[model samples]
Target: MKEITRIIAFYETLKRKADVACALAMVVYVEGSSYRRTGARMLVSEDGFWEGGISGGCLEGDALKKARMAILKSKPELVRYDTTKGDDNQIGVGLGCNGVIDVLFIPVDFENENNPIEILKKSFENNNKPLVVITNSLKEPELLGKLFYFESKQSIDFLKNHLDVGLFSEEILALEKSKNYNIDNELRLFVEILPKPITVYLFGNQYDIYPLIELLKMLYWEVRIVSEPNKIQNRENLTIIAPSDFSENLLNKNSAALLMSHSLEIDKKNLRKLTTSTVKYIGMLGPKTRSERILNELAAEGTKIDSNKIFAPTGLDLGASTPEEIALSIVAELKAVFSGRNGGFLRERELPINERNQEIFKFN
Candidate 1:
């Protein structure tokens, strides 16, 4: 979700600089194992330019057609694509794509009043701000509505309804303390209190770290560059340290570590302390042979490395070479892991290609 926001901001900025029109599409609901779900976005420009995606190739063709219509009419509409029918040649917007998806296409011009992504982007820029998505559930599927309620640390205001002010406030409170809350009922009017950005610990000052930081920054990640002691600090948000300087107290309150230091000894030393910590991710960047060696060495020293907890050879094997390319591959792998997507190709795996169904979304 955070990455999507950043990408929207980037596109919005580009649109402003280039004076281009862009339409934003979001998948508000999915009935079955569809390619994308609520919050999946695709931004299409006037000249057939696009960034982001709403679904796999299955529904994009239909979306492209609607995007052109939205641009021509300058009025957006809620669209649906149903693939429940087994027929592959079914036409029309609601024809199932072997699954059903409800999408809302909103034409957003930087100068328009209906530019929600841009407004949402502005709200997200301030870490302490909170916003509510007032979706209308009275309709079939869901409608994201033209109104959005937002409250920064300073003010609380509504774009549409003022009667449900109390309900909106309670939702804001829920989002403020959003440790774990079931948000099914709050689909349309889902309130997201923008909390602090997630912290990412990049454990290395190698040549690769530069591009990694750049990519992560573009994704709105709160990155901390951890380098060896006496290492000249270059980045603004960096922490220099010796091998022993690593401490639990130093880890961010909700940080995930990326082990790209390329030093097996330093990596193992930190892993010893981190294995028992509460870090969300500890991705080791290396080949399978080196990763196995580190695991064996940790085991030899009595460190019980949980197989499920570690992501070795961190990032997908996209045959990355240059630093920029490597960073993209690593970010893609991290996103897959975070989103519970198998990094392996769908055709290569025996599991169903679409597992975002109700059966799989269930998590303990």
Candidate 2:
């Protein structure tokens, strides 16, 4: 997400430098498993600065080299990384993530807002709806770099300099549910749905909440601190509000919240609000006994807390004693809940780690 922002933010800078060439790299398709899913992007300027990433680390350097070539030739190219064979370069590189990733490199005209990179960033700017990028070139390559948003009624053009397009409304409408679509034998489309940034609502403005806020920021997510309005500091992408101003309407249904005042009245008040709201996750920071007491109190008040949406004795059991470690644990637990995982050790789970659905695709 930060990478997308970086690309949009640097558009003007790239545009101003007439001689400075830049290339846009996108993970058009992924087979089996990958660290970053399809639609992941990275921007490489002529100055050797890459704003995003396509692979974990194995294929970035190689992609960067290709991006430079794309800039010089003023032509787009396709790059594929298949590490499943267990002998292809990863044999010595030591980092062989078994997966097949298809990346598309396009020379970007940052000056044009209609360019694929700009179009993508603009599509996600104000809309909560998922935007899909259709391509027919990721399979064996040739005519693929075309992009279109379903709602815009745009046509799919695979062999054009710019994607100025229209597909039937019904065709675009159906893609909302499907991830991959095959238009024809030669025109296979890999649909990439754009997602809005995840918002984390941290209830309680304790000193410890600062760490969690900082960490979430690193993940490039939106953070709304529901604490004393006066404690609100000047921060970017952060909303500070007093507990009195808390409202479920202010948040989306997918938002995750953590309750950490450790005060009975405060926790109870927040819990009551959470129990009636549509927000999906509510974490209460305390011991299991403490959680039971709070649940009983709420039960007596006739607002029975839904066990499914609540996380008591909040945070994973990582022997987190320090405030920082506790903050890490709580955030880890929230990340797990957001991804619908148990938040356990990866090694204990399975061998092909990429198979885990770390990031979930939300379909409006």
Best by lDDT: 2
lDDT digits (tens) for residues 1-364 of candidate 2: 6777787667657777767778888876677677887768888887888777887776788888889998888777767777777564642134556667778888887666667766676577647334454454444454455554544443444322332234333455555333555443444455555655678888876778888887888888888888877666655557787777788786666688788886978888888887777777888888888888989988997996779988888889999988889988987887788766888888898666544333323221
Residue 236 displacement in candidate 1 (angstroms):
10
lDDT of 1 at 101: 73
lDDT of 1 by residue, 1-364 (tens): 5646655766767666766777777665566667665567788777777777888666777787788787777765677677776555653335444566767777776665447666666666655465444334443333444534355322334322333445545555555322112224333443444445667788877778888887887777777766664564474565555556667566643577888877898888778877877776778887889989989998988888767768887777889988888788888877676656878877797876654433211111
For candidate 1, what is the lDDT? 0.65
Where model 2 places Cα greater than 4 Å from the true spot, the runs are 10-12, 84-95, 137-143, 152-178, 232-238, 356-364
Question: Which ten-residue region of model 2 has the weakest summed lDDT?
Answer: 355-364
Measured on C-alpha atoms, candidate 2 has an lDDT of 0.70
Q: After superposition, how far is residue 176 of candidate 1 from its true place, in Å?
A: 12
CA lDDT of every candidate? 0.65, 0.70
